[model samples]
Target: MNQDRILLEETFYVLTKKNSVFRVRLTRKGLSLIKESDNQEKKQTIPTRDIIGCKCLRSRKSTTSCSCQSLPRGSLKVVEENSGEQDENDISAYLYIYAYILQNTKSGSCKRERTIITLRFRSFDKYEDNNKEAKRWRNTIKQLIKGEQAQNETPDTPIMHKINEQRKLLVLCNPKSGPGRGKAIFQDKVVPILQEAEIPYDLHITKHANYAREFVRTCNIYQWSGIVL
Candidate 1:
């Protein structure tokens, strides 16, 4: 337990930069023991299992009134673990974001079709160690890649059986996205599938901002299966 006096409200610096959600892990029994602003103990336990994902929120108390939940998933490595090492790592723990599902009943008119059951939940995370976080990310990527390949694979179609070479796709990338892995992710996770499916693609590196856009404006649209932005 690497305990640090981290203020939850001020931790959005790392959260916003990551383009990720925050989460926390606590069982029903644990939540019941939490003290509220009124100095009264919570009479009930909020289920931890109900959490999924959350949109980043500015305040945590607002969601508490509703069945919504939130958890912290990762942490940032701000300072060096030791002095004069000339290196530092981003340190964070895994957390889960959670919320509840609710249904709405309308007045008058008897229409079963109009009834709606919508999700009324938020998100948070389960705190985990740095090594654990790395392992979790790796496993998740592998699982997602495997699932996508399984879904895209087709055995019956003649086109699937044969290699496709007639089409060429050009990928234009932007580096501003969180983690800066947009292009690498496409190459590692997407390109292999394209190759297996026998689709031809050409990758053109953009030297400056808006380079791809300027190129697209003057080019013939019929020449490709649409230019990817």
Candidate 2:
């Protein structure tokens, strides 16, 4: 996987069923759970495609002051200390985190049954931050699932029989052409036709003579299936 294409990579405190926290690496590829003592001794990977859904959980009541009892388990402890009492709503303080539900198929089983895996993040003081992170993760996981679904839905027919479904075109116009009627012509004539035909196009205006030719020479021609003047 290209590192440049990685959508998200962050260290999150995973909450366990025993009320313990484990430091895990959340990335586009999957979840990498790191061991307490060693980094590589005990590691687990969960592919992003396995994630079924994610939900952001919020506490019913908001509080300004909070404490963590299990710091030894690598939990994040956020404590805001102020001399005067402050309203929780004013501070925008709340306990929130993201919960991801994953499903994995059992291996070597006669009947295909999915094993449910629940992963949760540690609580955060600010509701906004928690909600933002949860939404980001949810969207990324959804994109992965959508890509997988699209791949599965595509036909297995040969490439020769396949038709290009993408409607893309490039339109070039000279701003000074025909006594400065290029812009007006494009707006009045070209745009309406393209819209009526339901065609998507990239428009470029020429600044001077031979400008279109120069642009065409430098541009990536592979992006457009057809070019229109």
Query: What lDDT does candidate 2 reach at residue 190?
Result: 70
Candidate 1, TM-score vs. the true structure? Answer: 0.27
lDDT scores in order: 0.35, 0.50
Give stretches of model 1 more than 4 Å off: 1-165, 176-178
Candidate 2, backbone clash total: 0
lDDT string, candidate 2, 91-195, tens digits: 222122222334344664343223223344335667566556666665555545334322212254222223233847888887787678978988996785455
Instruction: Give lDDT tens digits, candidate 1, residues 63-157.
Output: 13443333443322222223343121213332222234233457644422111111111223322344244344333222222222112223441
Q: Over 4 Å off in model 2, which ranges? A: 1-6, 38-40, 61-107, 110-125, 148-229
Report residue 222 deviation for candidate 2 (angstroms): 33
